[model samples]
Target: MNHLKLVFIILCSISLVTSCASERSDDDGIEPLNTSESYEELNISYGNDDEQVFDLYLPANRTADTKTIILVHGGGWTSGDKTDMTDFKNFIKDQMPSYAVVNINYRLADENNSPYPMQINDITSVINYLKNNEAHYTISNNLGLVGVSAGAHLSLLWSYGFDTENQVRMVCSIVGPTNFTDPAYLNNTNAVLQELLDTFGIDTATDFLEEVSPYHKATATSPPTILFYGGEDPLIPITQGTTMRDKLESLNVTHQFTLYPNEGHGWTGLNLLDTTLELKIFIETYL
Candidate 1:
């Protein structure tokens, strides 16, 4: 009878081990998350325009102190959708499951419409919407921003210049243009680039360029910032990141800047992993 009882206990232990292994396997790379721990709302409109919509992802444990990160996708302000931010949103959700995410779409620039006020307004509108519904969502008033390229530019501009309520706690820029009036941009002979400048009426006057440029707008009180740049990016000059880093330094603002030496407009492999870790650290530290 004692021997039989010992065998039964061993068998139960083995079953438990197997069940644990199966659960870990089911997780694959994503952390095992309770299905009830989070929820997602897609295509919530903030304004009348089709592009002025955002997707919200709320963690199950969200409360008034739960941090929220807003993601903006890059398409040179002429194209791109909130869908472009999915991988980024998923990465954040996977790494920081406690945080909420708001992925947004803004009006695209065209010959007839400039991106400046329209795109900037769209971002604030989304923020206002979130604030209006924060109680319903059970999220904190604190906000962080992570943006790529043109979207990054807008994020920086808004965080530095337009966040009147001081709600933005941190800002991250990936391959974003910082200085629209940089000589590299003004002197570049690329026709397509020139066309892009024209689309924003940047070539029309330096005043508009200064108005839209994040570097020109950054202040000492600007929120903590993390900037990523590619040394060889054709669309964005290295000065854009470097200059901003220098400006932030002069102002004594809390910031970090990473320039991948061999990278271009985007990264892959270990570079991507490095960026992910850097961003994780930045958000963890500030948000």
Candidate 2:
């Protein structure tokens, strides 16, 4: 499978989903913040690294009580940018106008810079920056994460393992890899998949794999989560979603899972619509 094609499909599908949802009216019963004006701050740096910047969208009438949604894009951890999630930012702005949105870019993984602690630390820094500036941004410390593919994995990992303050109220993972140690991954022969996993390290230890896996890090107190997966996805196997769903259920965590059996990597049309609708409901309920 062509990795570029996969990335293209993921981006296009997300755009299509959000675009389709734009035609629908918002009736989620979420009270809109009473701010008189909305604001957009672009390239707000949270750190010295150029990729450490994020774009923040503040809805009109937002206050210290306003909720926030942070979006993380996906390119198998090595590539992708905050701009890739533009449609998602727009979707949240239009649908959940009361909530603030942050679309962020983190240093991508490469031969020297591994994603493990580096990417996770970036997420931690982003959250810390948000919390530190909550008063200035006029938003609450409460956060909801919406991430796709690699971003989804990072979102889950950070929320489950790194968020000690319980700041994340909800998280949504779209076709993210949850378990690196799963048999489906360990026994897989996909070259692209192997290349992506190799970014973690060569001769990686089992303990390290489990340490990085969201499935292994999640606990009973993990925040409410909504998961979406494509059963036919070439990179992520169906078990990645099902096993995580089972684990969440066993932990008695608040969660929902949806599997599109016929889809692969990404989807469009009715499935995409369904995803957006379900996501909207999840955000309304949990965020």
Candidate 3:
């Protein structure tokens, strides 16, 4: 792997493994079933690139009222896959058995592909495919989104700005950067962070940062939102969540914000359960 990909992988591994260490136990030994009877499709292509595909699952008991939620994985916008969201997909199936799940892979940022318009466009294509084939899948066009970190950022940005069809009913952002223009990001001196920023094709001279930032794109018409943050997260500042929360409030947009005081970039154990419950409630109410 290249240096950037290696660095990104290590970062993701550490956060995902260690963040939830406190919550797992020897007794939590049962594993979720790998394949469900409700499998609708796998490796369904939405675009030209190999990464522009998704795995889809339907609830066995799905009906007219059943909804779908798209799950996007985080890897600092570069090194993650749809498989990374397997646990969250299982959580949704276990908790909300009536919902359909779409776990997708978008082209990661690299030397050739910048994240902003490329990633944003990929999500739009995925949504369009689902909407077009709703009958074949036996699903409603209304969709919700749950995403982590960079995925969360893309979810919010697309739902807020590019969802021209208004199919997205709600969104849940897990430790995503709501505002890239925040001083917390702009003033960062970390070399790795600087390198990552460069991949986005952003600079101080243009409005590129604001253009990609969900915080700047949110409007009164934005869909209902649920945001989760870790007070101690080293990557996403508490301000990213709080600032967006404040904006959503001022606009009178329906929303919820939760912060786990002791957690970092991610969490484990009961915190995961609580986050799941919150997600269920959000979907029940708005989606």
Candidate 4:
């Protein structure tokens, strides 16, 4: 499977799914708004760093009660920009117009700077900035996180462990790594996977690994989560999703897990459609 082609197909499917899903209304007490006055602010800096900026999209007729969805992209925590999530941001803006969208860019990790607490801190800063300026943005503190790969790992880690105020109502992970300490990772011989793990310092103490692993950080009170994975993914093994699912179940946390058996690190076509619909429903139910 050509990776680029697969990504294109995924994006196309998302656009189609968003178009189809937008026509349906739910009796879940939330009504879709019809307006043409949405707001968008790009390169809003939450910190001094160059990468500490995010793009905000405020829906038309939004209020302080309006919820938020934050998008985090994936590039092994060392690369990737906010633009990588443009498709998702647009999908949310069009399909879930009542909700606000934030696509963020965090400092990429390098040999001199590790990804752990730093990238995690960036997420915290983004949330703090949002809450501090809630009245200005006219959005609620309630949040839904949607991340892919490394971004997904960060979303799970923060929502499960670092969310002190319980602001995150729901989170969705697409091909995200959940457990750094999972044997699938620790024992895998894949150089690319190992290189990515090295950014977190593979030689570190076991406790530290557990500290960063969402599988270990999740508790009964953790927010509802939905996860998607591919059975044949070269970077993230099947255990990454299944283990987290099992952990969520053991803790009695509300969660959903979907696995595409023949796909790789990412997927497209009907599976992507299913993922988008499932994610949309989960957000409606929990966020």
Candidate 4 lDDT (Cα, whole model)?
A: 0.78
Q: After superposition, how far is residue 278 of candidate 3 from its true place, in Å?
A: 0.8
Candidate 1 clash pair list? none
lDDT by residue (tens digit), candidate 2, 1-287:
32222332333333212211111112333344336788777888877777888888898877778899999898777778888788778778888889999999998766677666888999998888877666566789999999988889899999999999999999999988898788765664556544444434443468867887899999999999999999788778898899999999999999999999999877888998799889999999988
Q: Which candidate order results from sorting by lDDT in descending order?
A: 2, 3, 4, 1
Which wins on TM-score, candidate 2 or candidate 4? 2
lDDT of 4 by residue, 100-122 (tens): 99999999776567677899999
After superposition, which runs of candidate 2 have C-alpha atoms over 4 Å from their true positions?
1-35, 190-203
Worst 10 residues of 2 by lDDT: 16-25
Per-candidate Cα lDDT values, in order, are 0.77, 0.80, 0.79, 0.78
User: For model 1, where is the 10-residue window of minimal lDDT?
Assistant: 14-23
Which TM-score value belongs to model 1? 0.84
lDDT pick, better of 1 and 4 = 4
CA displacement after TM-score superposition, residue 97 of candidate 4 (Å): 0.3
Residue 120 of model 2 has an lDDT of: 92
- How would you encode candidate 1's per-residue C-alpha lDDT over 101-188 as one tens digit per residue? 9999898776677676889999998888777666666777799999987778889999998999999999999988787678876665
Clash counts for the predictions, in order: 0, 3, 1, 0
